[model samples]
Target: MPVFGIFVPPTIKRLRTSLYRDALPFSKNLRLKRRSDVDPMGREVSSEDSQRYCNVPNLIISGPPGCGKTTSVWALARDMLGVQIKDACLELNASDERGIDVVRDKIKQFAARKVTLPLGRHKIVILDEADSMTDGAQQALRRIMEVYSSTTRFAFACNQSDKIIEPLQSRCAIVRYGKLTDKEMLSRLLYVCSEEKVEYNNDGLEAILFTAQGDMRQALNNLQCTVAGYGKLSKEAVYKVCDEPHPEKLREMFELCVHGEVFQAFEIMNDLYRLGYSVDDLMSSMFKIVKQIDLPEAIRLEFIMEIGKCHALVLQGLATRVQLAGLVGRLCQTQSRLASD
Candidate 1:
């Protein structure tokens, strides 16, 4: 446990334990791992407080969506402030319907002199999707940062830091977030499963990690989506109903279909369906495949059109398994579909 000297903002500190974890997009297992669990990656920044290092400090978190930028910031705040006034944690999504002026006004009110909370000496602002802000809005934001730096701290979160003005970038201690590793992601998911008393399959767990691509939130969300159908978790059950198909399994299935192993592909789809995979899940897998295959416009259009049909089926309440099986069957037959073109 090397110390990362980045001080947790007080607003995050004030979150109730339950709310903080619930707010996270990860599975129950991963959430549990956070309690008294150590970060094995040793990526913690153990220098001086982030405030001291970043002038007009703005943290630019770049990673895939669901990689925990927003949640991590909240966790940092919770650890710093204490679990009472997490509501004081003001968050504004620059991508939202509210314009920048409204956002600016909200910030002013939140940080106003009369708005004292029970915890922490100052206020914290989390500006989500900061890259979406217009140039005019950013100029206003720059002023806010300077005008209120004494009483407020800002945590700006975005998918890309390059969109931010360089002056703003220079002013903030940029903390680049990486994807959650398999071990860390698994540890969290397992902890949640234990609390929920879900029986899980080892293979299913491996599949989740492989497909999650270092995004803990997606891993957890997919897990929950799959398990919600059965109210119980098991590898076999997960495989059958899983909407987020494992990438490797999906690749294997595609190989079978493209190689004209119709029987084998059908068998795989059947196995997946029997294992509880939904039609929607299978369709989703096909979509991913189409995106990967380096096909000509004619082939791409044919595949996309077929995928669109399956997507429509999923929307029409077709059983998840049926939808998936149908997609695979159609993909296998698509050679003729293209030949007709």
Candidate 2:
């Protein structure tokens, strides 16, 4: 059962629209820019310049991890968009030293060195994590991208488009993706559950979703692992399998905080810390759980803000049970003030 064939993200339509826009007039525009030093080519061009001249503008798809950027790219290239992937595409990860060199050599060479292709086809080099390259490497890209504009196009996949240098960013058509909605994720999870014929309660599914945080790969992996170890999926089994703090306990902790029961909440927090979970795991899990806790909207926002601050501090290397206790104390204090008001 191959599922890749049917994979279409919610953003695929938008992607196709950006990717398939009319070819800009490359030669005519370059000819105009040629008289002045407007572009790297004697081609006077604005980074925001429009075209069908050299080729389609290179593509940059930005999104969070595991949101199907990779799948979407492959699907568009090999399945839906009729790209001859074997010949016309070169895929490389641009997150490490190897990528930098490739950016300098392989990508540059691939772009300049021409290959025969069907009419209207251009060679494509996909640079995953294009933003991770050093500033110097990216500067190199500015020239390489321009010089080879007529023969090849580069597709960049990055978690943050802002990290991409502006000149490169402007010459590219950008497509952004967001996390999958719970409804969308649940639908896919249900399909997986049915196809796998795994026994799972509703709570079991929810636990998977909670742990996955909208990542399909993580959700599927959690689902598979839960089934493999426990024989059936339950909320408890999922928590055990993922080794994440149980949401039930976290809910109880938050409930106590809302009731202004600081001592009891702190006790639960202490017990969780003693259970061998890292300080980061504790704060992160609580942060996620706090959002789902039934609380007054104002209280919810305050709680989130406080938890965010604690998480930030923890990330800066001050992780400790004392920090967690202090965060709990403040959360409880917030609830107390709300009650008094």
Candidate 3:
């Protein structure tokens, strides 16, 4: 029978061997190509020395969504743990089964088994979205982790590490992943386009990055969506796929706000609402514009404060239209006061 929806052991073992042989070398080769003095967590690990510490540890990989936390874990498992070693791996999403029973039953059952691999290797249990687990569940998990430390290694992936119990945090090697830079995201997108043989414009790729805001996975997905919808990638095509307001429109809106054109700003806000942008989306776009524009520091600070208030209202369940209108009105008032002063 399947172990908590995981594949049957024999079938998984068979598939793992072939996949490990074929895919493991790719990661190994990629690592060899880079002469990085630091590992992914920003720790200094000489290329030669890194190879010596290839053994996987009980790790907690934390980062924003689409930032490659989970990807790094799989790479470590494949590259460091050897072929067919994943058969001894168990992947769980703590968000899906957050009850203490899962920790007491499913996790305990999986971790209790000895490694099927040779010596100097370990069984890996990857608990994704681990921050979502209840405190009670986390407490149970902490004890289980101690009990299985010798036989099973745990890799916890989460967007926020603070939500994970402190005891659990102390037991693992924490690896922090940051948002990908635009240059890094663009390079990866170009690689994908080349491999898929999809033609793309440079400006179109930049547009995708702007929409993704440092999310590598989101950038790639946006690229694919644009290509699928338009049969190629262009700036206009990407904007259409994302359904985001044109940069010119955003510029005009900000200009109106700065010039104290309250009515015009409200009109633009309404139009954006009609165009299917949510209040949160509008606020996010406005904040981005605020950072880029050349404005008096005082005015910029005031704008940010207003945006924060609007966001707080949004969180309190105020109507989107009301909050946005109030934000635009407040911006106009601030501009008027600054001008009069």
Candidate 4:
């Protein structure tokens, strides 16, 4: 006969002892305290618990692109969840995975899961570009919000809050983020340069600011591009990255238009276009230059009105070249009329 081996099953008491032993280290690790939570700038930002709206279950943050809405959400999540943030937060881009399916499947599944941490804070679901979701998806989301309000909180970020359903909007605290001020932007740019050890001139910084138009993300990106391409930040490098006409050249084109030199102005515009400047960029630069034009009040007003019309056309999907050429022709007529007067 084959040798027989006797096996003894573990007792409940022994099993329980082993399970507790294995879990002891995990429990200790979970309770380990973090030293400090600081932002990128080394500032001690307030935690979510310290915020007045921490009690709010839902939030809607509306702002222009690159205005720090998403960054603020990240900071808030970090503050609330600490080391558990990555597992406690779900980030979804509505523009990318839009529709009721995502809201029902991914969002619902995540929200229904039991909280893993004992921090007493609800899990966070961040929906970026929230306004991009369809009406039906948004409607479905409203129901999910109701069902899971206790276990999860939502932070919706969008360029426009009006696109969200009224019921959904009413259920959340709406916060509007404004564009960064010139001073704030400049300070941030300077800080970046110091951190990167990149050489930059004031003119170059100003160029980036002007092109960015209060968008911090855009400003930083332009700065990086300028530095990477030129190995130094200068006004010319910034302009090159922006693919914008030089201020002096733009001024020349404006003067040509204002003086009824339509041919010359069109030639300049064509050359700039060939050089890769976008029509939108040209329009923006012209608008700024026109405002500073030293012309009579009536002429200035007329120019503003005409340019405004052209801009509206451009926004309406009119061919850029056609609208720009028409704008130049109108400016020529206006200048001729003013000269006669």
Q: Pick the candidate with the highest TM-score.
A: 3
* Model 3 stretches with alpha carbons more than 4 Å out: 1-51, 54-56, 116-119, 261-264, 320-326, 333-336, 339-341
What is the lDDT, from 0 to 100, of the residue 154 in candidate 3? 89
Better of 2 and 3 by TM-score: 3
Residue pairs that clash (backbone atoms under 3 angstroms), model 3: none
Error of 3 at 145 (Å): 2.0
lDDT of candidate 2 over 166-219, digit per residue (tens): 988898888787786677678767766775678999999999889999776788
Better of 2 and 4 by TM-score: 2
Ranking of all candidate structures by their lDDT, best first: 4, 3, 2, 1
Name the better of 1 and 3 by lDDT.
Answer: 3
Q: How do the candidates rank by TM-score, highest first?
A: 3, 2, 4, 1
User: What does candidate 4's lDDT look like per residue over 1-341, in tens digits?
Assistant: 23576554568659977777544422121221322321332222233544633564588889888766776676777767878887889999999998899998999999988878654588999999999999999999999889988778899999999999999999987888777777867877787788667898889998888888878778877887788789998998998888777777877877887778999988888888788777777778888768765777887888889888888888878847878789888987887787789
What range of 10 consecutive residues in model 1 has the weakest lDDT sum?
Answer: 32-41
Q: After superposition, how far is residue 45 of candidate 2 from its true place, in Å?
A: 25
Best by lDDT: 4
> What TM-score does structure 3 among the candidates reach?
0.78
What is the lDDT, from 0 to 100, of the residue 124 in candidate 2? 74
* Per-candidate clashes, comma-separated: 28, 12, 0, 0
Q: What does candidate 3's lDDT look like per residue over 1-341, in tens digits?
A: 65577556787888887677544322232222222312332332224533553455688888898776776666556655666655677889999988999988889998887666766667788899999999999999889888878778888999999898999999987877788777776666766677667888888987888888877667877877788789998999998898887665777877898888989989988998998888888877887778777889999899999998898888777756978888889998988787789
All candidates' TM-scores?
Answer: 0.61, 0.76, 0.78, 0.74
lDDT of each: 0.66, 0.75, 0.77, 0.78
